[model samples]
Structure formats: C-alpha cells, structure tokens
Target: MPIYSSDSDNETMPRTKLFGRQRPIRSVLGGGQVADVLLWENKGVSAALSIGMTILWFLFEVAEYSFVTLFCHISITAMLVVFIWCTSAEIFNWTPPEMPTSILDKSTFHEFASTFHERFNQALSSFVDIACGKQPALFFAAIFCLYILSVIGNYFTFLNILYLCFVCLQTLPFLYNKYEDKVERYAGELTREVKKMFRRMNSNVLSKIPRGPVKEKKAR
Candidate 1:
C-alpha cells in the first residue's frame, strides 16, 4: 500500500468543485465603485461650495448692515456650538466602557460620565484659552472690552465691523491653537482608555477560564 500525502488525498477526495474550469463571475452592478465615485464627487462639490460661501460671507461683511452683521455673528456662534456637540458625540461613540455591561442595559448618565472626562475637559480648556487667555487677571475682559469699545464708538454701524474684526483677531489664534492641541490630546486619551478597557476585559475573561492539564486537554 502506498502512503497518501495530504495534498494528493485532497485531490483524490470525492468533492464537487464549485466552479469547474469556468470563468469567474464578473460583478454586474459595480455598486461599491459607483458609490465611491459618487462620494468623491459629492465631497468635491461640497468643498467648492464651502470656499464660495466663505468668499461670499467676506463680501457680505464688507457691505455690511448692522442687523445682517449681528445675525451672522449669532449664526456663527450657533454653528460653533452644534459643531462642538457633534464632535463630542463622535468621541463618546469611540470610547469604550470601563465596566462591562450589555448595550441594552446602558444608562445615559453612565455613558455621559464615562465619556465626559476627555471631551468635556478638552472643550473647557479650549473655551478658557480662547476666552480667558489674553487677560487672565480679569476673565471675560475681552467681552467687556468689546462692549466698552462698542459703546465708546457710539454704537456706530461701522464700529460693529471694527468690533467684529477685533474679536476675530483676538480669538482666532487661541481657537486654532487649542483646537489643534487640546482636541487631539483628548482624542488620544480616549483611544488609550478604550484600548486599556478592552485589555482589562480580555484579561478578566481569560482569568476566569479554568487552567490545568484537564483544561488543556478539553481545549484541544
């Protein structure tokens, strides 16, 4: 009797080939490729539109009316708040649970508490740096200065423009710096926390598994 090798045994085994000497099926729909192309096109269009809008807003400011300027400022503030909230939500989703529990059993408070450490700290740090960094001795001094300047300049419509310019100048640097630094730091911390939690949970599960010769045999 001849010894059979694994490869020869496999070849000789009674089995039906799935597609016997036939050309592989070609994709008919091209769904994924089509979707990717569409997404790229959409992103390009969105970027173009954003650039156009920024230019238009600048032009609008130059030819500004008091009411329109105030409206734009309020709108920008609302947009910033919404943006921050959405970012915080994304961070929350990325973070892992410190304690193990079924998804269905999770409470809103527990979720918030677990996620708040990183997101809230980043937000607070950014807000403080932007609003309180320049004149730390008197917090909100920028706001106070703007208010005084607005009054001193006699509520002049053109002064609104000047005030807006000054506010942007003072705040933009802090915003850019904090946004670059703090948000990334918080994201890093959240990612590290998630990895640590997963490791701990894995260790806990592995520890609970029985260990010994019988256990090893059973595993096999």
Candidate 2:
C-alpha cells in the first residue's frame, strides 16, 4: 500500500513540499506576508542590520569588552523585560502592546518552565547516547573528541569569530537562494563522498571491535 493517497499526492506530500525543499528566497528573507511586522520583514533592512551589528562587534573588540560582559548585558536586559512585564500587568493595570499578558501570567511561566526543562533533559540524554551508547567504539570516541573541542572553544573564542557567524546568517541564505541548484548539486556530491568514506571506515576499522555491554539488551 502507498503511504499517500494516489489522488492527493503529487510529486511531494504537502508537508514535505512546505519544509523539505529550499525555502523560496523571497519567503526566507521576508517577502511573505506576516501578521506581525518584525525587523526581518525586508531583505534590505535585514542586510543593513547585520552589517550594523558586525560593526558594533568590531567596536566592542576595540573597546576591550569581555565576552562575559557582553553576555551579562544581554541577560540583564532580558531579566529587566520580564520584571517590567510582570509589574505592569499585575500592579499598574498597564501592559505594553508588544508584551503579551499571557507571558506575564503566573501559570504561563510555570508551563513554559516545565516544557523547557523537559526539552533540555531530552537533548542532554540524546547527547549522552551519542557519546556512550550502542554505537561502535571508534564512533563513540570520535564524538567524545568533538565534545572536548567544543568545550575548549569557549576558552579561546574571539569577538569576531562569535558574531561573524550571525553576520553570515544574514547574507549566506540570500546567496544560497540565488544559487540554490548549484549549491545543492555540490552538497549532494559532497554527501555521497562522505558516505562512501564512512562505509569504508566501518568495514576496515569499526567492524573489528567486539560488541560491548553498552549495546547489550537488558534481560527483561
């Protein structure tokens, strides 16, 4: 039996058609209509903001501001927003139009906290499984090495290395959209090569390892 109805299904399922392919350049850089008018709606404005933010990062570098201070300021601003929202909605009967009253409500915070905690635990468990789970010893070791490198990056980071990524986010998508077919062809070729390399490695090295207790089924 086919997974999709013959009449309804065309080249792709509705959900796949929506999300699986590269998003339209217009839709992505914000040509699509939205109920809210956020900063990212216009491509030109988005590009300008990214450039401005990159310049600000350069200024911060010249000023010798630490990453700790940069992150602290962001945290403080977020806390201030929460404080103002709670106080205004509860005591003054005044709430900013932009700040939703639902977010300030006590029950809403509890539900958000519960959901966040659940997701965090799920992510942590998945990471642990990848590092120490039933995978071959060599694969687990490789993951562990990558985790160590990620931890080391925290200590050696510079301002440009951190914020340049955000700057690239603004421009890279537009470029990709313009040259999507060429980019995808290259990506497909690269992926096939990587898969071939991994298969060879598995046959020559990983397959030699004996199954450890990590992969053993628990007697039920």
Could you tell me every candidate's TM-score relative to the true structure?
0.19, 0.41
Q: Which candidate is the best by lDDT?
A: 2
Error of 2 at 12 (Å): 19
User: Would you list the C-alpha lDDT of every candidate in the order shown?
Assistant: 0.51, 0.60
For model 2, what is the alpha-carbon lDDT of residue 70?
A: 74
RMSD of each: 27.3, 13.2
The residue-by-residue lDDT of candidate 1 on 1-220, one tens digit each, is 3232344444454532222313211111122322222233345643554465455555556655456766788799988986777777688885432443554334544544545565577768866776756557456766787689778677455644654564553344335333644654555556556656666666677657896755445564
**Residue-level lDDT for 39 in candidate 1:** 32
